[model samples]
Target: MRWFSSPLRDCASPRDPSVSRSRVFIYLGLAVTLLLLSYQLILDRGPGIGTSWTAIQGIIVAGDEDRFVPDYVQPAEKELVLAAMQASNMSWVEEHLSDWQVNIYRADAKHDDVGLTVPVNKGNEAMVYLTYIIDRYWSLPEVSVFLHGGRYQWHVDNPLYDSVISISHLNLDFVQEAGYVNLRCAWSVGCPRELEPARYLRERPDDKGHPTAVEYPDRFMELFPRAEVPEVVGTPCCSQFALSKTKIHEQSLEHYVRLQQWLMDTELDAGISGRILEYSWHMIFGKPAQYCLDQRECYCRTYGYCNMTDSDIQNQWVWRGLQLPEGWPEQSESAE
Candidate 1:
C-alpha cells in the first residue's frame, strides 16, 4: 500500500528513454565503424583493380602504343636507326615522330611502317629526312650490316622487338622448349643459326611405317625433345588460357548489365563470339571477368568494378569444355 512496488517493478515502469536512445546510438556507431574498416581493407587487398584500371586508362585512349604498332618486330637495321635517333636527341625525335608534315617512314614495308607523323623545328628537318632515308634503305630485308656497328647481321621481321622481349604472356611450352633461344642468341651473341620457322607443321606417319616427315626437323628438335613428341604429331597444338568459371559467373545479374554497357560503349562489331569476348576481357583484365566465382562478392565489394561480358558468356562456357583455342582469335587469321 505505500506505493507497494518492488525495486524491479519501479525500474521497469519508469523506463529511461535517454538510456534506450544511447544504446541505439552505440549500435549505429559500431555498424558504421565496421563498414569503414571493411572498405579500407578492401582497398588495400584486392586483384589490383585500381592499379590495373589506372594502367588501362591510357590503354584504350586515342594516343597509345597500340595505335602506333600493331605487332612485334625483330632486331634489325631500323632498330639501330631508331636507337641512333634516340641516342642523338630523344626529345627532338619524340616531338617530330607524329608530325604529318614530316612524314617518317620505315624501310621495311611489312615491319617498319607504323604510319606515325610528327612536327619538328625546321632546323632539324634535314636530319629527320636523312634519318628516314637511312631507315628505308636499312629496313630492306636483305640489308646485313648496320652503319653504326659495321657488324654483319640479319634483319628482324618485327618492329616491336623490344616489346616482344618484354612480353611475359607467352606460352609456357614455347618457353620450356627453348623456342626463342636461337633468336635471342642471334640477337645478342650474333649466332649464325638460321631463323626458326615462324610456322608450324604436322608430321604424319607414312604408309610403309618409315619416318616420313623431316621438314625442318633440326629446328623442331632444337625446341622439342624426341621423347616428348605428341602421339598424334600432325595435329596442331594451341592453347587459350583464361580464368575459372566460378570467378566468371558471380553476380550474374549485375555483371550482365555491365557487360551490356561495355558492349554499347565500345561499338564492337556485331556477331562477336563469346570466346573472343572472353579472350579480349582476359587480355584486358588479366583474368576471367565472369561473376560466378564463389568469392566474387568479396571481389566486387573490394574492387568496385569488374570486367564482365554477356553476349559470349554462355558460349564461352560451352566452348571452354572442348579445350580448344578459338578457331580464329586474330583478324589476320581470316585474311590468311
Candidate 2:
C-alpha cells in the first residue's frame, strides 16, 4: 500500500483523491482559459495566427497639421489635398492594389484620418506615423509610396512621363530611373552641394548623440548594409518619398518591425531618427557603378530598379574637394 502512493493524494485530503484530481483539472482548465483569452487579445492587438494578414503595395496618406516644431512642422495647406482625394474617384487605384485596405490620415480635424485617430498624448508624431502602419500591420507593401498631406511645388497634371494621368504618373518614370526620388527642390535638397561627409564627419560629426548617423568612407555601403549605421546620406528633406518593392523585399518583415518599434520607443526626436531614415531610404536600396560612365543611364537605374549595372549609379552630385573621402571613388581628376 505504501509503495503505490497516488499522484494527487494530498495529506489534507487523503481520503478524497477524486476531489484533488478534480481540483487539478479545474486548475488546468483555468490555465487554458487564460491562455485562450491572452491569445485572443494578441489577435485583437496584432494580426496574430491564422489572420490572413496582407500588407502589400499601396499608399499611405497621413496628416498631422498642428503638432510639430517650427522647423519640422508639417505644412498647413494639406486640407486642399484631402479635399481633392475625396472629390475625385480613386477607387480605380484599388484595382491594382495587392492589398485591399487603404490607410488615410486626414490632415484636417474635419475628417477621421489615421493622424487624427491615433492618440495624440501618446508619443505619436507625423514623421513616425508611418511607423505605426508597419508595426500594427506586421507587414508592408513592397512598394510603399508615402506622401505628406500638403502639396509641393512639383505638382504636375502631365508632362510626357507615363501612361496614367495620376500624380504617380509624374513620379513613376523618375522613381523607376532612381531608387528613391525626393522632390527635386530648389538647388538640390539633401547633402548640401558643398558640405561633403569626408571633411564634415571629423571636423563636425552630427552634433553628437546620433549613433545611427555616421559618415561612410564607402558611399556604396550606405545604399545597403548587413548591419551598421547609415552615414552616406542626402536630403529629400521632407515626408514625401517612394520605396521600390524589389529592393525592400531584400530584407525581412522583422527588419521593418524593429525599425518602427524603435522609432516609437526612442526618446530621440524626428530631427534625429526621422532625418536619419529620410536620407537613408535610397541607401537602403543599393548603389551601382563606382563612377558613372554615362550620366543619364547611371541616373535612370537609381530608383525602381533592384540591381545596379555598369550603367548603375543613381544621379547624385557629390561635393567638391573638401569631401574627398578615403574609401569612396576618388574625386575625379578634373574636380581635384
Candidate 3:
C-alpha cells in the first residue's frame, strides 16, 4: 500500500550520518505540506447539515383570490413565504428556486371567464391542493414545500407579518438540518381517550401520535371510502411543511389519486375537512405531527412563531373551531 510518506521514509533512512539529518528535514517538510493540504478540504467545507443537494421547489397554493372585499376571501399571505425564501443566504435556494407554482384556484367570475369551474369556498382548497400535489408536483424530484397561501398561521396575537418574518428568517442551514421541517401553527392535541381510547394511528409508542387525539371514524370513512380506520387518529393541523420530493415519491400514485378523489367526494364544510385532513396527513407520510413546545425549538422554523403564545393556542380552538373536548380551556389571553 502507498502511504503519504512511504517513499520519503526510505529516502530519509540514509547510510551516512552526515546526510541522514538533512534527509530527515526534507521528509518532515514534505509530510507537513501534505498534511496541511489534506486538512484544508475539511476547513473549506463548513458545517453542513444533511440535505439532498437537489434544488428546492416552493409550491404556493393561493386559492384566496379576493382580499379587497372582506366578504369574498381573505388576501393570501404568500408574501411572507416568498420574502423568507429570498432572505435565505443559501446560494442554491436563491439561485435555483423552482419556478413558484402559484395555483390560484379561486378566480373572479365577474372580471372574466376563468377556468371552466371554480369553487370560491375554503372547502375547495383541499381539492385544488390535491390536484397540484398529484398531477403537478409528483414529477418534481427535488424538495417540495407546501405552504398555505404562502402564509403562516399564528397562535399569538402577533401580526401575521411578524410571524412570517420570523419564519422567513429560517436560513438555508436550518432547512438542510431538518428532514421535514414544519410549522406548529398551534398546540398538538391527540385523540380524546374517551373517543378512540388510543393516541396514535397505529399501536405504537407516543412517537407521532397525540395522547389526546380523538378518533374521527366517520370523517375517515368520508375521506377514504374504502380504507379502514387507522387504530389511532392524530390531529396535526395547518398543511405547512417542507419535504423532499424523494420522501413524497415513497407514497404510491394510487394513494395520491385516492386522496384527491376522497377530497372531491367529501360533503363536509371547510372547517371539518381541514380537521380530517390534519390527522390523515401524518398517516400518508407514516409519521407523527410536530407541535412546537415553548422549550424545544427544533420542530419548527428558525423563528419564534413556532413557539406559540397562550393567545395563539386559544385562537386555534376558539376562533378556528378545531375540535376540543368539553374540559379544554377557552382562550382568554389577548392575541395582540
Best by TM-score: 3
Candidate scoring better on TM-score of 1 and 2: 2
Which stretches of model 1 miss by more than 4 angstroms? 1-13, 44-216, 224-336
- Lowest summed-lDDT stretch of 10 residues in model 2? 75-84
Tens-digit per-residue lDDT, 1-336, candidate 3: 754667777777657877788999999999999999989987876554232122222322232232111111122212112211222232333333333333333322332444211333434345544544554333453444454432323321123322344344443345344434454433434322112423234543443353223335655565566666654443434555555555566777667666765555666665566556655665566454323334234323434336655665444333333332232234323431
lDDT of 2 by residue, 251-289 (tens): 565565445444555565545555555554444456421
Best by lDDT: 3
> What TM-score fits each model?
0.21, 0.41, 0.45
The clash numbers for all candidates, in the given order, read 24, 14, 12
lDDT values for all models: 0.28, 0.39, 0.44
Tens-digit per-residue lDDT, 1-336, candidate 1: 475768887877877889999999999999999999999999887676654433443332222233221222232311212312222323433343222112233322233334422222121222222233222321222111112111111222112222122122222333222211111211121112111222223433232421222232332343233323222221101111211222223224333333333333432232222222321232122222221222222122222223424432222122222222333223222365
Question: Candidate 2: misplaced stretches above 4 Å?
Answer: 1-51, 54-102, 106-129, 132-142, 152-168, 171-179, 183-187, 191-201, 204-232, 287-336
lDDT of 1: 0.28
TM-score of 1: 0.21
